[model samples]
Target: MPGFNSEVRKSLQKAFTALADHYGVPTERQHFVEGPPGKALADFAAHHRADVIVMGNAHRKGLGKWVGSTTEHVLNRVPCNIFAVMGAADQ
Candidate 1:
């Protein structure tokens, strides 16, 4: 639903702002892009010529690790290096 998408966007924006503030990241350095996760990250990194993309990954094990992970997709598509932190599997 459009309403649901709007709510999610607002929630993400709020969380982004909060984290940026807590980390002392300037507003100009903070970006809240709305798109498919992997594609958005890849495109942003390429456009900005980023040296590295730091992200959280739900580090999976075995066969599960090779399938349907945004981190994997970004790793393959992004032009820059990636530093992935292990996050909860449910992510």
Candidate 2:
């Protein structure tokens, strides 16, 4: 499970890097937090005083109902509007 998590993190880093390069976006300030989803998000928002929360709406089925457990938790706990970017199929 640790190996799988590492692989996923690596893949996400590579993808984010590519995206930043392609869009000319800076990644120097990017931060990744691994913790209780709701608390993590709330902490980030409180510390940064972020005006909005942007998240992906992965349309998973079965036991993975809702946007995602973490995302749902953040949405409920955070004191700001959420901007969910759904996949094409979600439409």
Candidate 3:
């Protein structure tokens, strides 16, 4: 997490918290992750016996999308499933 922006990270976390809270989902059971998201997600799912991973994509274009995306990273390797939804591009 060196050179990481704490403010941005906190803001992103709050967004998830707010969404979960609205649906009465327990924050206590939520998890935070670092490093490669695909590996972390797959490992967490396997450990927890989770049936699926739900995520949003910023819909990267051109080079970054072709080079490799987190979505592609986990698609074939995960033990379970992934449900990716489209969202506005990251600013």
The lDDT leader among the candidates is 1
Residue pairs with clashing backbones, model 2:
none
TM-scores for the candidates = 0.77, 0.63, 0.62
Q: Return the top candidate by TM-score.
A: 1
Per-residue lDDT tens digits for candidate 2, residues 19-86, read 77798877775666656657788789878888899887778886454467768787777778888777
Model 3: per-residue lDDT, tens digit, 25-86? 88787676666777777777778888888877755777554324777777766777788766
Give the lowest summed-lDDT range of ten residues in model 1: 59-68
TM-score winner between 1 and 3, please give it: 1
lDDT of each: 0.78, 0.74, 0.72
Candidate 1 lDDT (Cα, whole model)? 0.78
Q: Of models 2 and 3, which has the larger TM-score?
A: 2
Which residues of candidate 1, in runs, are more than 4 Å off? 1-3, 63-68, 88-91
TM-score order, best first, reads 1, 2, 3
Steric collisions counted per model: 0, 0, 0
TM-score of candidate 3 relative to the true fold: 0.62
